[model samples]
Target chain A: MSQGRERVYINDVAPRDGLQIEKQWVATADKVRLIDGLMATGLARVEATSFVSPRAIPNLADAAEVVQGIRRVSGVGIVVLVPNVKGCERALASGVDEINLVMSASESHSRANLRMSPEQSLAQFAEIVDLAKGSGVFVNGSLSTAFGCPFDGEVPQSRVLGFIERLLELGVEGVTLADTTGMANPAQVARLCEAVMTRWSQVPFTLHVHNTRGMGLANCLAAWQSGVTQFDAALGGLGGCPFAPGATGNVCTEDLVHMFEQMGVDTGVDLAALIELSTTLPELVGHDVPGQVAKAGPADRRYPCPAGL
Target chain B: MSQGRERVYINDVAPRDGLQIEKQWVATADKVRLIDGLMATGLARVEATSFVSPRAIPNLADAAEVVQGIRRVSGVGIVVLVPNVKGCERALASGVDEINLVMSASESHSRANLRMSPEQSLAQFAEIVDLAKGSGVFVNGSLSTAFGCPFDGEVPQSRVLGFIERLLELGVEGVTLADTTGMANPAQVARLCEAVMTRWSQVPFTLHVHNTRGMGLANCLAAWQSGVTQFDAALGGLGGCPFAPGATGNVCTEDLVHMFEQMGVDTGVDLAALIELSTTLPELVGHDVPGQVAKAGPADRRYPCPAGL
Candidate 1:
């Protein structure tokens, strides 16, 4: 657990999470180029691709090739998403450093998103943890829909806690509570974090929040107050919950890192380099990404405000 | 002194703070109509106009007439901005219940916005406070450019606290710390609020944060942690910072209130009513305002998502 507060650990997901939600199919080489560019920016971690079935996510069908073709930077850790045991095996073959296992908290959301119930997902998580442990690979579990579910309105706090306990028992190193539907308010976040912190004081928790209800950063602050430090954000605010309505963008990684570093909290990531990486994204992904900071630049960068208005 | 957590005080500013930066000159009757509509929605405080010189702010030249035309609703407190002693006298004559006095913390911003040095502006603040006290009118002082200034880059925390101490010495009842250039990062906000709260434990402070750097909501959460509750926001994200580059909107009042209420924080204002009031704004102001909650509807209010992206 590298808890040296001097730097922020940026997990750039421009290749995996950023491209997965787009309607257009980006070429495999373009994906590799984007990943290479992100790695050059000194981002500590990068999610390269998901080894899910091609029939489900056509955009990431070249997941294996993207991982194989990219010129890997020496110090950067390349992580990939896995759906099931087969997906985990595929990820191991790609020669990645880490594995991210995702499961939904709400039964309704789990069925809709991953096509599994809560019990089945928990069983899968245990198997994934066991597999990673045997192969000497690190495992990070994501409890999606921890905040609220689009299919099922409100997920009980106990359910989220229970899932965390189960994942901890499975020997997962870290956990991320995701706002899959962006239904989290600060108070709910505060109350839940306080409860979890009271019990599992040493558990490493990360926040993966969406800006759907416009409380992404606020929710992050609430989690921060409760002693959770790590945050998961997509560069350029790309990626959306295909099932979560109107929840169309992740908290922009550049924007989050900017806010953190400016506050004197070190995320160890370079914002200028991240902004530069953002510039080449539109050509790579086909359409412009939705990050406001990327398009408008930082607070100091000036632009021509419309005349007279 | 009303610390009853259930009763949240909402001070509507569509007429004064909201209209000052607007490029279009709204008619006096339309302003009155907008105020009337806002009042009908159970609002207690509505800022009617600024008593500045006609040439200085052309949009609010007919300040007195606008205030006088509105049939002041029973129990609704009409407030107006008073730039100096003369403005205070004029606002009192216009039959407003409260007077708002503002001065920028940064010297450059104070000169650009108020045409006075910080010392001169504080002198004006003292005179206005005295005039309001003599006339039995309530006075609320605002420290603009408290967070960060567009001209001077980051405004020091010491300068902001020093200004607050000066206002407290002047017997000002309430104070608002404004992000005039919208350069507030969450950490900066948290550190400043802690400083203010540690020094002045009893003084009530309101945050008038702008969304220029996209940290408006994050700054709000930081303040919430520091125990400062009141906030000033425009409905429809109406106003923009005259100095911060591309900073073209205030934090939407409905959005702020919604986030607060959802977190069980008791911001007594009605979100639905605020939304309805936002809809009537375009016709009254002769153009559309920039609030997203009004256009996108509330978090729970969902629309049918079209076919997959």
Candidate 2:
């Protein structure tokens, strides 16, 4: 419990991870409103949108408009998801503060999802990393299926280490270990984070997990214990893997914040505001969302004494 | 991580704690069916019913019949919730293997919920404890609101230790520290369990947490790290404090079991069978249940490769 007082960093991935698979097309104005709502709650970093081809993810086809429509705050950094050099070029012109590059740890997943071998994806990333170096934009490399690959199953830790080494050498400022389909357990999370943190002590490491198996936050806690604090969560748990049929969504950002704040960990989040915004998600998506704090409220929240009692 | 491989004991409190507040009167036979289903999943302990007045908890009014009707499996124990000497007398006659006595650490919660002051409740517990010493039944004293009280708020660790001393002195074989309204945080849970285990090393400590703030499993993980292993959870996250207005439900037993099993901690539970039973709960209660794993599947469950991919 010594880490109870430590401040944990959070990066909301709702606009990118959460909304990627939404069938209902949200208006660009609505996406901008949601992003502004999240920024108003004191989140330092918000993954606002992704610059993928409209044919790849039509729901986020308005990514450029979203970045253009959302008000920019002084301290909040906006993140844009980019897959290749072309996406990076679009993101650089889109005025985002950071760009996140995606790759896969397993060749099967890389071929199925990204249509490239791991090495091919890394080679493409090298160009994107080099292209963005002098543009004043931070590049974050994310390794998908780092915990377990649905297509191949049981990704080797050595593959993750190799990817990390190459990503760092590519001049990426940070790396995200993405549990693309929520396949990680706490023990596995601890072992991987320990191995990575021991060797590359200076590189910023973040966890991108899903609640597919309901171990998302448990894995986050294990990562924190292993000395990795930065995390990526989605508001209302909006996103899931389209290829992975049963994958739920990324860990709910508000629920994660509620847990951290309750445990006396400083998250620099306004829980009341977050919960309030979480309630509006059901109407936004035309369905009820998966967040918990919106339904349960904070721990100290009190109800009025019953009439008779 | 050191405790990742340890086996944790689970007491499925669905019949007693779960159905106690259910609006639909789950037929007495349905209760028996549910209990039988749980027992077949290799769970060692099942809290069968409560022996309180039928008018007090009408849902469990068939407690005696449920105890008599459920199929008994070898190596499994049935526990009943008892509030006073009369409940204890009835539970003893019903032939439950264990009886859990309830009191609250906060005087306000005790009076509001049980209509007795803390001291008066303990005095009555003394008689109930004396009556069943040689009756071949294990006595468990549960301090409700020991973690935090909705009425009084922030129950002190000193008060909990004082109550633990009294319960142990009264010959209770075990004590369960209950987060009655889900107010306990992870750090608070770790600190309190550490203090209690330090003073009463021989007493069996179990955790009974609610998901009021969605910290149920997190608190259990904290308590587990502090050397407490036994826990009480409800299937499908059923049951909350009927008196605490905003309290949600207990930790989802299958979700907790899934998390533990994924981390290589054994609960001897057949997860596939438990999951199968969880899918039937929505029809049993006529509404959606709160459990996560049922909808999300297990961590290792893989979907078939899509045709094009």
Candidate 3:
């Protein structure tokens, strides 16, 4: 069996991707506090907020304030999602450590979700990369629907590989293959992740999965077995696919860390602290979140014998 | 990497282990219909009910009625949990294809749940096995808390292995290692499953895991990677750890089947039919279940382009 890397890296995206679709608007101060709490849990990175148009995503309207209000810790990268050159400029002005540019691997999903074709999104990424050229901010490209698009069924490996090459060629320092609609299976994840890791031996690739079909952690395991080390997760499993409405979103950060840590893989995350933070999410979001570890406790948690026994 | 097996076997325990703890009583007719619905989905087996005392599990008080009412199809084993010689006799008299004898691997859990020690449970199993000798009923042993115990913490592998030997010697046709309280990790699962499979190559072993810590599917993947082919799942994720009150129950049946089927492994199950059956769980049990696929649809489900796009 392929025993993956000894250490893994986690980037919590609850503030940006997670809260983007919520009906209730999260206060800017609370967003900052959530990001700060995430950062203190020894996460490799935290996608704090997004720099998209406020009208498009009202929940993250105070992105700039959220970025500015959070404490910056050394060695922890603060990332913000940037949809285009305009968002990139705003994210740069906010002094973010990294700006993640978004696009979709499938044409239909790209047009429907981003209001642009894949080719058009690629052209925009080039412009965004150009703007961040010497600003000391890392540029990362995220390809949505990299596994399978909800509108277009299967996304050919050739198409995903071609897009990854173009993103890297445009000076994007890293790439994240996102299962935007949670269509990824473990076998597909292993095959694609292995192909990408082998072809791009030097690139830092992150696996971003959703638990829409309950395969989030399973796909993560398959990717790790295929040599992936970085992952994008959301606190309390808070994110959802806007296209697929009720489907659950990103893999829960605490659950992922718990799996890796239990496997003896070093995630460099404080799971207890992360679980503690996850507890406050239900009240913060005005509803129950999908996270399990917070409710179930850790694997080693011991319970007292039942009263009569 | 270990590709494990091309074909997997799934046994649904929804009617028994699942309803055992529900405060809402599912009617006997509904239980029969549920089992019939599950059996029609081409499951390898359906653990229809448990022959334990009705007072102990009032929801399953109609176990005999359920087993007798369901349509028994050829090639699909009908199994029932039997706690003692009395339960075993009741199961055999009801004409069940298999009698699942359960005992916890850990001391505290065995005493707390079964009101007996491991030795006492084993002694009772020998008597039950003797009773079922000529009845043509397949005898299966399930070791609960095989991975870990809620009160005693980790259950040593030596003790589990020793118990498996005793069960096999007592003429148990199969063995299932159960992570009863959802306290198992993937690494531990892979290790223990590999050990048991290696030591008992000819014995049919099933893996029963809980989603309490959100490692349900991941642990299943690990066990499959370690060469386990048979699994125990609950429909709609209906079961919960009675000892750990708020924790989620057995890995959802449809979700497990979906993951394996998506991975290109044939589980001899109809995913659509299983998912359709999962949808009726809310009305039957008077609560929304924890299953994701029933709510999110399958990974291959397609969505239409937004109105403007």
Candidate 4:
């Protein structure tokens, strides 16, 4: 019905987004191991680390080391999150494939999380884009809080589009619309994605959703129906910005992949490998993670039939 | 966009489906209180209890008393699950607004769960439908495992439609398609629901989905998009058939309602009241329930802003 089977690209952000907010420090070796496991799953893209200030996010203090340590899988594009020009330098120095720049769509969120206004953040992005233009490493601009903000009840769509306009003008290769606080509904996701894709039809627009209100996958379905093929998910449904405390984290990568593949949509990533990696998350993070697929198993997974039958 | 506001009916099955598999024996008073609370949430239909062999499901042994003890809310239809003539007669005596009859769509499932062949099950339904015809009680025929069965890997679409054909011929007033073992995907749900609705256009077709593999709401969305309106959900997602041991509970009523209502679809139920009722479930059941809204709060629920912001 949707033409032919669509291949959805999963951009795993577990190592970077997941562990960044964790109070328990994941050792650098473990970080590399998790990234390697994800790479072996045949994912086309994986966000391995964030080059943010060590003092700000101590959990990812060994970002550059973790990036350098991973055994790069052939054909897998490695990505790293960068907060500023220093992070950009660090990521470029690590030979990353993509440099993901972060900024908040809501001014209140920008002030609380990044301590900069949207305009100031975009001004900084211009310099980063110029630096990455000839570095062979593409820049992806992520607009956080694109849906709604905790401090600001509703973010105007015009405000989000204006920021996207500025990011495109800065020559960023792509954009990721993030539901930072999980304040999104299926209808809202469909409408916004359609509008954005209408203008940026060729540029890849990924949906970075959270499961905070448990609409992460639902929003993804809506977005996919609206022609979005790329998604940002963490390993165990882990990670939420500290500023947005109650946000559940990104949608689980394995869970998302399982649902898509079972629906006849191709996610390219190997679910068995991802699920095996998912089982090790609790031990790796020193606490249980919140993903249902790993515990419940995949959709087609059958249990022993009733004994008598 | 969806013709102004579309109203979707949510049938609360926490009492019948939710507590039926719960190990803890809830007091009759608590059952009545729960039904009453659900009534106050403006739900139009609620499945209060199931009258089955106590030997089979001891959890709902006090079905009759519990059904009669509930304080009826005006304009709300109270339904009960009935297995046989005896159960139907008891439900009639208790003055139930509707009688929900269930039989598995898969032959293997019917044999293991209902311990009868599809032919034998339909033959029994004839007498029950005849009894309900003149008694002014509506009979909702529920076909469990309509999508997939654990025992029989994939239940053919032909098999499900055959059951629907027999049920409709048996003089049933409505039909409900259930994903008993949670072995349904969005594509499968959309295809089956579309086929069934196309054939039985005007019937009050309902969807009863499980979150076993976390595809409950996603399947519901697919079904909804395919024009299936009525849905059966449990409060706090408190159910799983014992015979189908690992299968999760029905979709969470509040979660589904929240998603639908937020998408500009009217469910005619008060989410705040439903959420308040969800908070009391863990204490009522003596264990935690599987619902996100109660823990994470609603999408609009806001937290205190950071100091600077």
Docking class of 2: medium
lDDT of every predicted structure (CA atoms) = 0.77, 0.86, 0.91, 0.86
Clashing pairs in 4: none
- Say which candidate scores most in TM-score: 3
Off by over 4 Å in 1: A1-8, A241-248, A282-290, A295-309, B1-8, B243-248, B279-292, B295-309
Lowest summed lDDT window (length 10), candidate 3 chain A: A240-249
Cα TM-score per model? 0.89, 0.96, 0.98, 0.97
Winner by TM-score between candidate 4 and candidate 3: 3
Which of candidates 3 and 4 is the stronger one according to DockQ? 3
Task: Supply DockQ values for each candidate.
Answer: 0.29, 0.50, 0.72, 0.57
Please give, for residues B129-241, the per-residue lDDT of candidate 2 as tens digits: 99998999999999999887776767889989999999898899999999988888777889999998898899888899987666677787778878888989999888876
- Across A1-309, the per-residue lDDT of candidate 2 in tens digits comes to 745438888999988887787878888999999999999998879999999999998988998999999899988899999988888999999899999999999878888889888999989998998889889998999999999887788889998999999999989899999999888988899999999999999999999998876677778877887888899999887788665454458998988898888777788989889888888888888887777678766767665543444
- Higher-DockQ candidate among 1 and 4? 4
Query: Model 1, A1-309: lDDT tens per residue?
Result: 112344446677767777887888899988887888778877778899999999998999999999999898898889898888889988888889888889989777677677778789778877777777777677888899898776566789998999998988989877888887667887788788788878987876778887765677778767766666777788877887554443447877888887777767777677898888877877766776656566545766533433332
**Per-residue accuracy of model 3 over A1-309 as CA lDDT, tens digit each:** 436488999999999889998878889888988998999999999999999898998888898999999999988999999998889989999999999999999988898889899999999888998899999999899999999998889999999999999999999999999998899998899999999999999999999999998899999999998999999999999999766655677999999999888788998999999999999998899988888888888888888888877
Enumerate clash totals for all models, in the order shown.
Answer: 5, 1, 1, 0
Model 1 chain B weakest lDDT span, ten residues long: B300-309
lDDT of 4 at A156: 87
Q: Candidate 2 regions off by >4 Å?
A: A241-248, A307-309, B241-248
Per-residue alpha-carbon lDDT of candidate 1 for residues B1-309, written as tens digits (9 for 90 to 100): 113344456677767778987777888888887888778876657888899998888999999889889997888888888888888888888878888889989877777677778899888788777777767777888998797665666678888888888998998988888887677877778788878878888887778887765677878877876777777777777787654434447777777777777766676577898888888878766776656556545556443333231
